[model samples]
Target: MSSLAVRRISECFVKPQFSNQICNLTPWDIVMLSTNYIQKGLLFKKPATLIDEHHFIQNLLEKLKHSLSLTLFHFYPLSGRLVTHKTQNPPSYTVSIDCNNSDGARFIHATLDMTIADILSPFDVPPIVQSFFDHHKAVNHDGHTVPLLSIQVTELVDGVFIGCSMNHSVGDGTSYWNFFNTWSQIFQAQSQSENHEYDVPISRQPIHNRWFPHNCSPPISLPFKHHDEFIWRSETPLLRERFFHFSAESIAKLKAKANSESNTTKISAFQSLSALVWRSITRARSPPSDQKTTCRLAANNRSRMKPPVAEEYFGNCVHAVSAETTTGELLENGIGWAAWKLHVAVTDLNDRVVLEFLEGWLDSPFIIQMGRYFDPYSLLIGSSPRFNMYGCEFGMGKAVASRSGYANKFDGKVSSYPGREGGGSIDLEVCLSPQTMSALESDQEFMNAVTEFDPLLF
Candidate 1:
């Protein structure tokens, strides 16, 4: 691909138009204090009926900014920064919004001459897309100026790309999408000249009440001397990213195959898909027969909590559940074996287990050290098909395609999103070493079920 250049047109901080306040970080937020922020993005085709391209883009940018300012009125935590206590016991910390600082989400506008076809023509994510991500630069600016939310708007020749990064300490995928969808609603209303709808009804506003078990203790801050350094090793191999789409029919067939083994309960789309990908990745790596491989699944705990937390409750409420097996057993057996492994891990999550896990965090908040986010022997799965990323519409139309901008930063990381067609299909973003990816593409069994991503097909 030829080199493409990007020019920065504008940059500014967007503060909340409402009052500034401080919000305490609950135990759920502290659980992810050391994890990396999550990155989500959307791609939209340029409106076909526009007569003036320049005016359309200018109005779109301004509408987004105005809608975001109103969004902060409902979700003010996005305009806040995390602060750590210096002398308090257990070093208590909270998210605070100060009136004297540039305390708002970063808004940026850049122009690139590339077209949508340039990115999707090869059926692979281009390296140039990496420039769209902020790379978490200067996140700890003097340990005082950190923005919880940042947005980048890139205008393409035939499309527009919207990328956002949210600090994981403030919310999980559910909360992140909540803010995005709500912002889209506000923007849609503005596009229709319904400015009065800016004030979201109380029923749809986010609930900030952090829930904890009775007799909960304050979580201690984990100490990491070099928190700014990348967790992956410097000598890691070069990696490549690819998108894979599974149709509703393909998933149903896999589900049938998984359930045929036991002739009992059937596995879910998530379990079947994860099993297929896990096996494909394991084989591509060509690990030793005796070596063990692990798959860490990001499990949401909102429903697992006692009495169940409200759907609108914001903050991080996810736990990592791991499934382990020897490469020999995984390959020798069928996909059913792998699917069962994932099913059990999710089924084991319950109220008692979740409560005990939170209590343990308060007693010892040690940031557990493990393999890099993209370890060769381990695979990490992020996001879920349940999140309706395709439904995020900002008046122009629904997104043609949606993906995570940071998926390529690490190898062996997978992020799944609901298919654009919205009928139980799935789109997976897989990252792996270049050598491993080449092998995976050639594996007949793996490629047979895999389909190249095409927005129109969905």
Candidate 2:
């Protein structure tokens, strides 16, 4: 069994150079109040030829904490707390970020008596990985009392893991990756320079202004008075999580097959991959032919907006767009049919559809209830293959593996990540019931498409 030891726990604040600022929560941010925090981590091999392991790890922790403080200066909203306002007469709630409070982000350092192989060798994700992140089951609304962002650095026998837990209300996957990449860039720059300064200019500057349609105002209020009214803190059932890697060649073959079978050129690689997994999981469950199934895709609205919101806008700018069909139709029609359905659903989510959803949301504001939002028969696919997961190099080297926390995870939850090799490859982190996972592993057709990983590669 693996053992973990904690070395330190401290709050790292932004530099005193910037003044206090306030950021109002948009409808995008408000909708995520009840969801779980976004947890992600990267694994790297220890530096070669270390004189003393303890000394090296201590030095690394100091550098990481310093760089994080600098990074928070630009992402000030993350370092702040969520402030809520309530009204008795109307029974409403309003939430915003008070950047002036400056409580700072949480930083943790620890050591684990395990090797990197213990993490990457098993077919199922090791339960020990969950210990790498704090706020295991806490929701975004908890940010009111807890730190808005918490980071943990765990040193393994031969490698290190850096994990982050950020409130979902503050941003989506886009914002999360942006903050991570920027921090890595700053850290890398400081290591290369002699003075160890964090003055390196970031490639992208995040925009804090909340976005809304014309005629719509800020401080959108919810009908509920307290977060407990909608928060879900139920215990999740036992499940199995596994990483499936699809190579560049495998992906191209799937795409070509999907497009050819569907006789349409617009079927995208993402749609194709989604179709494959959707069908595989559905088959594994062995549901009745008449059973209704759904595929919910997380779409970014920055480009879908009419005038196009800035790509660098740093808040939640994503929506869940779904495609539905009967189990019989989804499986009987083949991968092309499923892919086409996903393609149509994604392509149809244009500016007009987005505007109508926003206008309707203004009329009736409600936080997405955790246990009630997703259907048991449905699959929710989050994250994207386009994110630069392997590019977060902090002088040690490129990340050897990418993993997420236990936040917002359900039986049918799936998160897509870019492959470590950096081609057109893709990796999916799939969570499902033990029975369903067992059935999926035995599905010959599905297994044929998966690219097996060798533990030694880590």
Candidate 3:
């Protein structure tokens, strides 16, 4: 593998449409201040008709930057910086986005002498993939100094990779992917138009007004005087990250088996899969039979709200719904029981539950930290199989693979992506301790359900 080389780095700002805009962070956003940045990327095969790699890359970079500038106009908050203010009387801290002094998003261009196959062929994701993103160890609150959004475009020997690192405090997974999809739409529109400077209209207009329950106000101040009081920084443990592919057939089987064994029809495909993962990982770890294990999943609260928020509401609108059980019961009762438990947790997370969580946050403001929110004994699942990960063509072609950075990675962190084959198939990006991962690979029952993929299929 040849060394990676940096070609250029610059800033891309939103089109000058408006000025002096400021968005206050709500409790949903405030809770994410101490969390890791959202880092994700897509892989695209180089155009076959291209002859001059240098010229192709240069043109692609320019178009991407321009399209991003246009996209940022709709997502202007992304280009702004997080401003922290200290209140004297109350002696608290407040965070907000200052659009007037926007620094714009960071844009990086680089080149690598490796094929797309080199990235997708491995069972274990190559560590080099992490280098494609910026702000590796930074948290969301670092948006004050670091750009709220960072994009890195790496030209490969046979393909290209577009990686982005966005402040988690600015948005959740829904908001993250909405920005991505709109950006790609603008890029593709530019490619087809004769005018290089054409401004395309966005398909879905984003709603910037932060959501909060009645009687709850903006500028929610935290009790801490300094961010360091709640900020968490720890050494990451040795872990192995691998992609587990579940075909549509396998998904059906899991769902059917779960529902049949539980003797209920309320189980969903996601719940069934989650149950399988929870049980399998528990069995692999072989924890004490009486030990308590938990699984927390990020649930989108848009539809769960009484008066549902628009799908395009552009901020954090998710809450972590969790299920807990004893290792002995989870293992003995089988995947159906485990999945049923997950279903109940999700079903019970109605509008009242979401309102309660927000109300409690108002009384006592705090941020999510590593050791406090998650640990090795539990699992934290984020992202969703429904996201249009493969739809980001950018006029080059359909994405061949999807990857994420090491910003918020920890043992038992799982991110889900839509499978390349589509049609209800799903791919899980699982991270676990080396010992647990080794055990998971050797577990026949779990491996039997995973769909084997040929590297060339990617």
Best by lDDT: 3
User: Per-residue lDDT for 37-67 in model 2, tens only?
Assistant: 9999999999889899878887888888878
Worst 10 residues of 3 by lDDT: 7-16
- What TM-score should be assigned to candidate 3? 0.96
Q: Residue 270 lDDT in model 1?
A: 82
lDDT of 3 by residue, 282-304 (tens): 89999999998999888999999
Q: Is candidate 1 or candidate 3 better by TM-score?
A: 3
TM-score of each: 0.91, 0.96, 0.96
The superposed Cα distance between candidate 3 and the true structure at residue 223, in angstroms, equals 1.3
Clashing pairs in 1: none
For residues 92-143, write the lDDT of model 1, one tens digit per residue: 3333333335458888898889988787767568877766755343222222
Clash number by candidate, in order: 0, 0, 0
